[model samples]
Target: MDRKKNISMAVIKRIPKYYRYLKELAENDVDRISSNELSEKIGFTASQIRQDLNCFGDFGQQGYGYNVKELLAQISSILGLDKEYNTIIIGAGNIGQAIANYTYFQRMSFDLKAIFDINPKLIGLRIRDVSIEDIDNLESFIKNNEVDIAIICVPKERAQGVCDIITSSGIKAIWNFAPVDLKVPNDVIVENVHLSESLMTLSYLLNESKITE
Candidate 1:
């Protein structure tokens, strides 16, 4: 399917939810489902689901709905899950270690090649058989290896410095876990996962609900 240019981020974000639900349906041996049925399960209105999917291409039939496995495969391809990404985490601290231990990323084709840290104690320590290397080796490692994405799990203070090292070493994509955002060249893409901000959002929602109650 030919992807249309300038798809809105809101629609892009919802695509993953579609993929997840479709994957679950596929796993359960579901053959086909109407958009309304999918809407009930995913909490999106049927019209909204159809519009979001139409951003990519025509999907599902008027009467028959979508073929579960086929739709899952299509969404997977759209999300680039079909390709493998060699990823490295800079900062073998708690967040870093947890990410390294998550095998689901590997199943999604994000291979954790190495982990880097400034701490000498963490260096040489292995998480899931991938040894944590010294921060000093980071540049050379990226230079020698085909590292596609750099995962920044370092402190906010050091996040930019590590990002600079990664970008200067010719890496274009970053999965930043640091609270602070990193400035990058126009060609580079940074996806930030700020844990504290997410927690704060949940806290705000919880308090808002309590006030309403």
Candidate 2:
């Protein structure tokens, strides 16, 4: 199998925990580790880890294990954290401002390049060095710039429309924080982060705990 196609986001997401555990092992001078050992430390079944790794071809020997440093580098590159990605923000609201303020976004190789909104008051404003432009300028700006990702922070009612505009603007991936479900084209990737649902889940957990008590 093609190595790039073998490593997926599902497997990539688990790499951090695995890398942390491997780092600990490396600190102890453990040069190699078995699948079973990784499974034990990360609470995954040995077979599952093996299956994920199999996508990238067999990295372990029968009795020996994987090289910690090599596996870490492989996983890091797969997650795309090894290079910087230029990002744009749709909506210059409070939530959008907060995302712009996030240092981890830059630390993780995501650079905030610009912001967009329909509000005339916000248009031409600057936040964190990225000027807020009129939403009408989205297509031209995105086309001329190197924006690879869009962060949607618009109101729930406007989410879908805004997303459609963003997709039309040629952004392939979106990190959406709007309350509404976005309907974009098939080629576009939309990741919704519903804050209300998360809060409701916490509320349900608190209620369930009270019942048990």
Candidate 3:
């Protein structure tokens, strides 16, 4: 596994929260930022920000603080957003098509390169600006274009098989939205996104808070 990819996967998950704070700082014209200040803004402790920043090599001065521009650049590089990543989404169902039409990644540093489905009806259809491609074309497309990541939105039963095919096609990273947990080789990185789990967590928090009132 590429160490850069490993570090990036961890840091990319934090970009939104960090970016929000940085954007506020930029609006306020705050130049130098201590880790503590960054922490307060993001609801993390100053030491946590310092430690996370240290993972990509020191960016903050011992006494002063981190230069906003420098720190932003470092975080950007670590998250692998300095360059664009071409992504393929498997399964052209509702969620998949929704993701295809989403403008969030286009506004950020990622691009939705293609979509795949086994249904012949969907094979020729277009989602967003990108057209849906048959699963049979996945290997050729990935090989020819050098796709960086894949999104697995297929049914839980088919998720593992799709991931296997993706790995064989040379994609190293995956964003799996299936309900089941997937097993992959060490060389492949699978990020499982269980929306139900998140919603349940939120529900639990709200219920707990309500009891305290």
Candidate 4:
């Protein structure tokens, strides 16, 4: 497989959607699908689908289309779902608890190894069999464990502090839920899930639709 590097972020973002739709096709026992057929199901233009996939490698044949099962496996590997990631949540608040309770992440190979919080009452509590530890133990725990991702769900005011500890401990990736933007070394990757911003974006789209109508 001839894979290209520095692929645009727009294409990278669409890869997960392709993986999801391809998984559905595979689950239904669909053996093959042309770009146009996948386009109809996935809401992307056939040419766009072809172009996006070409960034990775030549996946489809001229007449044979794409093998559903094979494509799904390739996309899965592309998304790094083929490997296990040990994850720790740095806050045991509502968002943190909700994330911990979600078992689907484990299904995708993101293992929740621990949860940390400064709250005395939340300490020693377990969510999905993972005990919540005191924040003071965060650095030591990371040192002892091979943590691949750190989730920052602490309040905005404390998010950066928690992030500093995580990055300092050599964690390369972070899934941040705090509203504030975090600064980190260039090598560290942060994916922010700002709920309020998402809601406001929805609100804007709703108003725009009303105006257009």
Best by lDDT: 4
lDDT of each: 0.93, 0.83, 0.82, 0.95
Candidate 4 to native Cα RMSD, angstroms? 0.9
lDDT of 2: 0.83
Angstrom error at residue 136, model 1: 0.4
| Tens digits of per-residue lDDT for model 2, 106-177 | 877899988999999999889878899999888888889888899999898888887887788788999999
The TM-scores, one per candidate, come to 0.97, 0.80, 0.84, 0.98
- The C-alpha local distance difference test score for the whole of candidate 4 amounts to 0.95
Top of the candidates by TM-score: 4
lDDT of 1 by residue, 1-213 (tens): 867889998998899999999999999999999999999999999999999888888888889999999889889999999899999999988999999999999989999999999999989999998999999999999999999999999999999998998999999999999999799999999998988999999999999999999
Clashing pairs in 3: none
In candidate 3, which residue ranges exceed 4 Å CA deviation?
1-16, 27-29, 209-213
Q: Is candidate 3 or candidate 4 better by TM-score?
A: 4
Total clashing pairs in model 3: 0
Which 10 successive residues of model 2 have the least lDDT summed? 1-10
What are the per-residue Cα lDDT tens digits for candidate 3 across 120-208?
Answer: 99998887789899998888888889798899999989999998888888899999899888888889988888998999999999999
Evaluate residue 30 in candidate 4 and report its C-alpha lDDT on the 0 to 100 scale: 98
> What's the C-alpha lDDT at position 26 in model 2?
77
